[model samples]
Target: MARLCLPDGAVRGIDIQGAQTGTVTSYTAGRDGTVTVDNPQHERALRQYGAFPANLGGRSTRGGYRCGVCGFAAYIKTCSRCGGTCEKES
Candidate 1:
């Protein structure tokens, strides 16, 4: 199982293939901006959608970057949403 964390109040939609069939399943973040994925496919889908893995202690891991233009936070050095430079966050 995988636990993905997003910014507080952020919402994300994830689409993954069903385990037993070819159907596509969709998932959304919960009220606290977290999603728990029970399958590897779901985990990959959530990561692709910009959700990062949550630390084991239930807090977001630090040392990532936050976009200056759109305020998106991720591990990447560049902002994928607005093509803006990202500043490292403590």
Candidate 2:
């Protein structure tokens, strides 16, 4: 004998804005619209997770800029730690 199982009224509709993708292992939305995911199974799903561009304007303090090559934050034009040039103006 075989049995069939189906969701009756317990299942509710979900409104996801990123992408209609693979099964969700975890989901979270911040008050500031920040989101992150871990261990995304599908490539498309992972891309969708990071589809939104982060608003990075006015986030850094009045000091320096991050190094584009090595991702170092400093006040000087060149990063002392990684020796990378600062691309972003602070």
Candidate 3:
């Protein structure tokens, strides 16, 4: 199984094999912004649609910055919420 972290309102189409036929399935991100897929096609499709691999360790594996004032995390050096400076996370 593969775990992906989807942004809010992200959706993807997947192909699934049924008993005698195959069908295209659509999946949407849940409230926690995560989805678990067992199919490789689904994983690839989700990644193509802007979903990234989830890091279970509670830290981003992509290496980004975090806002010092509002605790927001992103790749930008400035915080979008609190208008504070963001520091690079080690």
Q: Which candidate wins on TM-score?
A: 1
For each candidate in the order shown, give its overall lDDT on alpha carbons. 0.70, 0.44, 0.67
Clashes of each: 0, 0, 0
Give per-residue CA lDDT, model 3, range 6-90, as digits (tens). Answer: 7555544333344334665656555666778887877877787777767532466247777889777757899876889988877
Top-scoring candidate (lDDT): 1
Ranking 1 against 3 by TM-score, winner = 1
| Candidate 2 vs. true structure, TM-score | 0.31
Candidate 1, pairs of clashing residues: none
Shift in Å, residue 76, candidate 3: 26
Task: Show the lowest summed lDDT stretch of 10 residues, model 3.
Answer: 12-21
TM-score of each: 0.48, 0.31, 0.47
In terms of lDDT, the poorest run of 10 residues in model 2 is 1-10
Residues 29-82, candidate 2, lDDT per residue (tens digit)?
Answer: 344444443333332343443433232333542455777886666667888778
Q: Candidate 1 residues 1-90, lDDT tens each?
A: 887775443454666787778798766777765678887877876676667766522235378777888777656888877889988878
Query: Which stretches in model 2 have alpha-carbon errors above 4 Å?
Result: 1-23, 26-28, 40-46, 49-85
Superposed on all Cα atoms, model 2 deviates from the true structure by an RMSD in Å of 13.7
In angstroms, the error of model 1 at 37 is 0.3
Badly placed stretches (over 4 Å) of model 1 are: 6-12, 56-90
